[model samples]
Target: MLSHHIQINDHPFHYLGWGDRNDPVILMLHGFPEYSGAWAEVAEDLSRDHHCVAPDQRGYGQSWAPEDVNAYRTGKLVGDMVALIEHLGSRPVMVFGHDWGAAVAYALAISRPDLVSHLIIANGVHPAPFQRALAAGGAQTAASQYIHWLRREGSEEQLAEDDFAKLSSLFGASMDMGWMTPERRAAYLEEWRRPGRMRGMVNWYRASPLRLGQPGEVITDLPEMPTHTLRVRMPHLLIWGERDTALLPEATEGLEDYCDNLTRVTIPNADHWILHQESHRVAAEVRTWLKRL
Candidate 1:
């Protein structure tokens, strides 16, 4: 495996890579509060057959973290992935994303399907389904209260205070932390402490127009999303951790409505951090699923 930095859209982007460059590419995208290293275990398992590349998307880790919230908007976020794929000299590479990264992957697949061969997402929501659940205002709404909290002014300061005590708590929230040992925790902290990185990560939430609605209230003011431009035609796979409290299974409820070739798998034992908590299972599922492609 190798770690390298490249310029994408005039911004420095850092990524971790594995496997021979000549092999088919499998690009991995990490979620919030985590960097490219989040896919270490899965990348190691898949590198034998496929080249795996996981980037610290624009505003995370050692990548360029723009101070403006507008810089983290969906179009800009998807553009970063598009530029990186072009930079890698590959067309329509297999793409995988988790959490916030998954949202970017979805956007990329929708907006620029020519750049994605297959879309694989774990524990991430399709915007439409997520919006429905977020607007419905029940379990998902309560679980997503953190989104509102993160959007507050000075929330980044709180996350960074007390040596990132509040941020550290996010790892073990309603889930097991056995995978996050002292060393792993230290590494995550190192990434989070990068200058301006924490704030940049929070900007993703701030830039999003999705908001948590009151119980029994549905959002009707969502911006128009033209159907022709917002659907996924490439084969798509969704690996879900059934126990993810933050994003319930309901988030995947209507995913197929937007995907032409869709497959969904639920890992009963896993939670939000399934990539780390159940790397073997996740890797095996990915391998088996990709074989059909």
Candidate 2:
């Protein structure tokens, strides 16, 4: 793996690259509380056939992080990826995203279909169905009340206290976190402890316009999704760790209607952190899914 700190859109951007430059590229996007190293294992395996570019997104790791909530807007997040693609050949590369990274990837594909060749998401949600589930105020909204906490003022401070015990607990979140070994936790703390990184990371939740319905109450005031433009024309792969508690299967219930070609796979033992819990298995699934092309 090679570490690079390129200036993408004038801000210092960091990414980890694996494999030969001439190989097919896969842009790997990590979600909250994870840095580019989150994909190190999977990328190491896939590097034999494909080059993997895993960026630390905007608010995580060594990447530039502005504390203002507006700076973390969805448009700017998508634009950062667009700029990264432009700087790195801008070809229609395959995109693999997890958690919040999936949000940026989906928006990038929807806004500029010419830039993304294939879309891959692991235990993430598409906005339309995600919003629907949140608005329905069912299991997902109850599960997602954490968003409100993250959005609260000074919550980031609370999360950073006690050597990040709160953040660590949040990361575990009742899921099988056996993958977050001591070494990995130390690495993640190194990233999180960076000045302003915690607030920048939490700003993602604060800046999001998506609304959460009161648990047990169906919401009629939810915003409308642009069904006309959200069509994902590329081949799409949805890899699910069936045990994800934060985002239940209902979050992806109607995802098929938005994609031209969609393939879904489930891993029985893995949860939201499937990329970490089953890295090799996930990599194998990715290779098999790509063979469709």
Top model number, TM-score = 2
The sequence of per-residue lDDT tens digits that candidate 1 reaches over residues 1-293 is: 79999999887999999999888899999998899999999999989888999999888999999989999999999888889899899887999999999999999998898899999999998898888788877788878888878998899999999999998887579987789989998899899999999889999999997768755666777766555667999999999998888899777777777889999888999999999999989999998998887
lDDT of 2: 0.91
State candidate 1's TM-score.
Answer: 0.97
Residue pairs in steric clash, candidate 1?
A: none
Best by lDDT: 2
Give Cα distance to truth, residue 202, candidate 2, Å: 0.3
